[model samples]
Target: MTPEIVEISFKGNKRVPYFNPKEIKVKPGDWVIVEAEKGIDLGQVNKVGRLVALFEIKGDPKNIIRRAVDEDLAKLKENRKEEALAFTVAREKIKKHNLNMKLVDVEYQFDRN
Candidate 1:
């Protein structure tokens, strides 16, 4: 049977379950956009199968908006560069203020929010 829900993995290894409400066919390793709290977000398909048994969803499972296209992929690449720059800047600022904390990764929302 086609899986009603699939697992999507984002940066930092964050994973969430989303349903193909529009019946969009997706497979593992395919990048996809999904509904998010603020707006749409992007992630890669990590697993495809019944997931309700595995995940304790806090609310309704978000829908898979669509598979990522070439343009979306290009934008994601740009987002990564921006995120890295932001990370470096933050680390420098932390060091400048003599803050005793490690600045690890910086993530930019897919929409650059």
Candidate 2:
């Protein structure tokens, strides 16, 4: 299937990257990989349509890529599970090591490439 290359912006300040059509071939309900500042981000496609306009991109358009595939989705899910376990391990490690920093939150971004 052919995915469409699209621009993804975050926090109204940073533009993650461009996504090729091959990367976003899945339907609207499918989970796709969006380029993010930190890494590849996972998000469901909210809309899809034909390209109508082109504008000057802030960063290089070549940096943008595509959506995630089944393998990618699986890896992402596995990573999330691992991330949760890592958080627990980290908390325990912090307690054992007597670190001063407080664990407030944990965030994970997948498919950042």
Q: Write the per-residue lDDT of candidate 1 for residues 9-110, one digit (tens) a residue.
A: 999999888888777888889999988878889999998776444667677778899999999989999999998899989999999999999987898878
Put down candidate 2 lDDT per residue, 1-113, tens digits, no spaces: 63354534332233333546444355555555555566657665443445312444465443335555798878777767877787898899999999998876444666423
Q: Estimate the TM-score of every prediction.
A: 0.88, 0.51
TM-score of candidate 1 on Cα atoms, chains taken together: 0.88
Top-scoring candidate (TM-score): 1
True-structure RMSD for candidate 2: 6.0
| lDDT by candidate, in order shown | 0.86, 0.55
For model 1, where is the 10-residue window of minimal lDDT? 49-58
List ranges where model 1 is wrong by over 4 Å: 1-3, 51-55
